[model samples]
Target chain A: MRLSKKGAAKPDPKEGADRTKDVLGGTEIRIAYKMGYVLNFYREPSFRKIEMELGITRPEIVTLIFLNFREGVTASEICEFSGHLKANISRGIIALEKKKLLRRDVDKNDNRRQRLYLTPAGRALYAKYIPALRERERAMLSCLSASERKLFEGLLDKLAEHVPHWTALDEL
Target chain B: MRLSKKGAAKPDPKEGADRTKDVLGGTEIRIAYKMGYVLNFYREPSFRKIEMELGITRPEIVTLIFLNFREGVTASEICEFSGHLKANISRGIIALEKKKLLRRDVDKNDNRRQRLYLTPAGRALYAKYIPALRERERAMLSCLSASERKLFEGLLDKLAEHVPHWTALDEL
Candidate 1:
């Protein structure tokens, strides 16, 4: 019989120390930490696989998503928009450009700044990936109901209201 | 004037693109990811702080917590209990012993296995850190209501259940 590619059999939790099993709500800490842990796993394969398959990480997807809504966006604007550090955005822009997905042009009005626009290829790639990415996103969001997702998004906006440096994302 | 030492600035979302800001829904992903991110940021500092203060890391704390409940834990057992990989637990034991926080005794009945126990210092340190940690945990948890935290933790656990492998925490 063939085992699923996901992994081999699950390790029995019973064999470990019994006393530690329920210690200090051990179960909850494990649960709370799971989403972050799973994100790492999901990202590694999905980003690499999808990026190789389509050539973009989710962050890059965010970049394109925002850029589509507003063209002539600056690197600083992207840093602020994506909440990604400048170095990461800089590197991402470099990667996207290397793939000929986009291009950067010096702002005619501001020499100190550069404006970003998607190349024709970028537009095509974005069109290709968004649907697939949205599918995956929908699947992940399926864990939450529509009303729950909206309320959760609202609460997230509240908690997230605290991050001000994102305004200076250009300095990122 | 000097900026705050920790730079715990809250992010402002209105200024940036709203695309990725609430993409994951709820502050759950942002808060937790930020916690993990902050933990990673202070990882070196946190590790050194614990070493100088209590001789432990976040992962080691989990180990000590588990060991406190049950002494004489084997490497494989610790790995299983902590959801860490074998390599991580191995390294963790080596580090704990180096700090004199824990000791591994060769199982008399089983030559191939060893049992781990925390030193007196480990217990003392745990007692000291627990209160401070509990406070920070409460602050984070306060972002959600009692019921939301319950549902959130459940979602996180379900997420972790899907991940195949994590860091080699067991060996560490």
Candidate 2:
């Protein structure tokens, strides 16, 4: 769809030619729009594929991926890292436990808290799902040359590294 | 929270030191994780502020932002652009119309279709809300040098422009 309505100022002919660029708006919101645009494609299609193939919900997939990397963590930690709601993550954990894909143990240090770990079945499921994610990422980045891809990765690394400093909104 | 469980292999000493990097995991999922991490901070905080101060829901805020650039579009177009569910966007449009922040007009080309436009009040509210979003984006990008920021934006633009080509996942 066209970003600018009829009779709106069109400063850039190139932008007008590219519908995607037009939909992204001007420089003020361009960064957010572009990032959101790319991320949407990444999440929406992948989530659909995962759900259809694996019969897992979005939050469950997130839990599986998180537990794949870091076991022995509380659901709260997964909620924090995944940006999912606590209730959703909790539900996901419960569902996974029921499916025998994950198991929980009482934290030795904190009896009230339960830590989550992936079962062997969970690991195998994650292994099955991961190659699709890898392939998706490869296709997404195929537009760039090898060096450009590396540069893009480095830039994303810097942004990710800087997240904690500005995540809190109390100052805003 | 630590990404790797205790006794997990630490292939990169530098990665071990940076909690964010660790949480992002290896190259296979690093890009998705990094993008999600940054986008989460962008959405979660800004959404909280918008909800608290303006009493707008996430979908409503998305509707406002999309209409700010492009008027006379259908809710379906907004859904497609924003990556939000159709139900949420419909609810947002109804809410915004009830608030007198947006108005609908019959599409001249198609009588069955109604087009959405921002009311003057809606535009004013969007105007008031945009600076904070702009500032948030600026703060997020402050980690990069001017040249690096330009390069990063270019990379994002490339990815955004390329989205339509690979967004469909029938082959996957």
Tens digits of lDDT, candidate 1, B1-172:
1111222234333432243343323222343343333222222232345556864555677677667666776777555445555677778778888888888888887788887888998778677765544443454455567777776655544334423232222222
- Lowest summed-lDDT stretch of 10 residues in model 2 chain A? A4-13
Per-candidate count of clashing residue pairs (backbone under 3 Å): 30, 0
After superposing candidate 2 on the true structure, give the runs of residues whose Cα lies further than 4 Å from its correct spot.
Answer: A1-17, A169-172, B1-17, B169-172
Cα shift from native, residue B135, model 1 (Å): 4.1
**Which residue runs of candidate 1 sit more than 4 Å off their true CA positions?**
A1-24, A27-34, A37-41, A48-85, A106-113, A120-158, A161-172, B1-93, B105-116, B121-137, B154-172
Q: Report the Cα lDDT for residue A171, model 1.
A: 23
**Which candidate leads the pack in TM-score?**
2
For model 1, what is the alpha-carbon lDDT of residue A96?
86
DockQ of 1: 0.17
Q: How would you encode candidate 2's per-residue C-alpha lDDT over B1-172 as one tens digit per residue?
A: 5544323222243443386666775435778778887888787777788888999898899899888877887886677667887888999999999999999998887786679999999999898888988888888888889999999989988887776665542222
Chain B TM-score (model 2 vs. true structure): 0.83
How close to the true structure is residue B16 of candidate 1, measured as C-alpha lDDT?
25
Q: State the TM-score for model 1.
A: 0.55
